[model samples]
Target: MECTGEQFCSIIMDNMVEECVMVSILEPMGVVTKKVKGTFEQIGSPQQYSLCDHHQKSLVYCHRTMELKAVTIQGGNNRRARFNLSRYSNASTTTTNQALPVVLGIDQWNLSCSKQTDSATPVLQLERCKDQLTTIGAQEKTVRFLFYKNTTGFSLTTFESAMYPGWFISTSLEPSQPIQMCQKQDARKLINFMVKH
Candidate 1:
């Protein structure tokens, strides 16, 4: 597909799909590495995003703590560039308001959560870059994220690990606390975030 200035496209996997757009390179965008037809193509480009926590206000990366933290943001804060987002390609037949596959990144690193260990809840962390939606046979990557959107007239979204479906990315109500995963039925309001593209 022709991507010209923020088109609605989903690159769910490493390979291309029918509904997926070409925006491959995440860090530095607009520099086409390969030649498709002696022209430049937008390959793997990542759009900088700021996730607003419903309760804590701001979801940011704590450089000192080396992890994501929840705090107050006034006037968009100064850490918007710390996070980036891209949608994973989904080839579903029906176009319901269902959760779409996506990949969350902290700059160049991709967000990932391991499967529950010893029945313990999984925590979200940034790891080396990889196409999370890339699957082999029946095995899906742990780096994949499920993007859930709430259509209650507000742009609220939640990121759940594809490895574990019900678990979501959450933050603490108290400021400066680390961000982790929580259950859907949890009474906390931190899971729902307003994704500012």
Candidate 2:
């Protein structure tokens, strides 16, 4: 069933539901968190001298919230073509151009954009993967493009270059929706597509 904007907002407000959904969504998207695994040792005396040793595995925790800002459908199609989510803290104002991370899940294929749309109001796109030849595994997968707009004034190219030395030169693009392309694969394709389009 399709989720309406209201439903999306409700889901975001419900922390329990959001956590569960995010875990399920991120897994198939190949966003795996670092898993810490170890054992425990016990050495101690009976009464006074007792040492309790324990080993714990730390799992990466992902915290995400969604605020439904707008909903748009493709031309002549009833199916929703896009949905926008505003990611902001409680103290954040709507008018301010704040960079928020968006995770886009299109069918099975998932891509993240550092900024979805520009600083122009918060919005995101959920588009279909019409081109099956893009990637082998991506054919049957639905495409979701997460967008973020870095208003911090620091260019993504600069940051990515410093952060990931061997990475390719990052490019910029203005998608149908507001999104900041970041993923290595998506960034390359988006830049090329934007240039040609």
Candidate 3:
């Protein structure tokens, strides 16, 4: 049940989702290749064993079919203060939209296609601000999802490094109900499930 940081990072980098049971994960980047049968003359050469042009087309087709499912969760603590002064009769009135403003966050997230050579499962931990009741006033609020090795409990800096140029957010739900960190497979499944029900 426990895994080291190195082992965990390898799994995440490799895009292996089924190793972890609690969470259902999917990688859109997992490309499937097919062998093309043809003579050296018909094809190009035996030395080139990579997927044929047709095979590459098919792989791309398959990858596009299993991309991430679209999910939108909206909830943010934002407060606005307004003041109005009237010149006549010294009467002034102010109005405020006290409701918690919701923003469309995490429209889509895809899984990595790379495979993991190691056998460790990756766990994602979300960190949020401590002051939940108070509005996030004037300061930028950030949510961080940390991928850690379950056994060693060490952070995978390499995995973090690989995630550059991509956007992610932290979830406030329990580990089992981590809607924020839904993997590609689970996201698709959940979307389908929601549609059916």
**Candidate that would win on TM-score:** 1
Query: How many pairs of residues collide in each model?
Result: 10, 18, 7
C-alpha lDDT of residue 7 in model 1: 43
Q: lDDT of candidate 3?
A: 0.21
Q: For candidate 1, lDDT tens digit of each residue in 92-177?
A: 21223545555667756767777555757776776675543433111435433433333223565676655565667877767767
lDDT of each structure? 0.56, 0.25, 0.21
If both were scored by TM-score, which would come out higher, candidate 1 or candidate 2?
1
Model 2 reaches what TM-score against the true structure? 0.19
Query: Model 1: residues >4 Å from true position, as ranges?
Result: 1-44, 74-76, 92-96, 130-138, 142-152
- Ranking of all candidate structures by their TM-score, best first: 1, 2, 3
lDDT of 1 at 183: 77
Order of models, best lDDT first: 1, 2, 3
> What RMSD does each model have against the real structure?
19.6, 25.6, 28.2
List model 2 lDDT by residue over 1-197, tens digit each: 88999998888788554334433311101121221112111112112111000111111111132221112323442322232222212122122233332232333333322223555222232334444322222112221232222322232211111111112212233222222323345522221111000
lDDT for 192 in candidate 1 is 69
When 1 and 3 are scored with lDDT, the better candidate is 1
Kindly provide the TM-score of model 3 when superposed on the true structure, using C-alpha atoms: 0.16
| Candidate 1 lDDT (Cα, 0 to 1) | 0.56
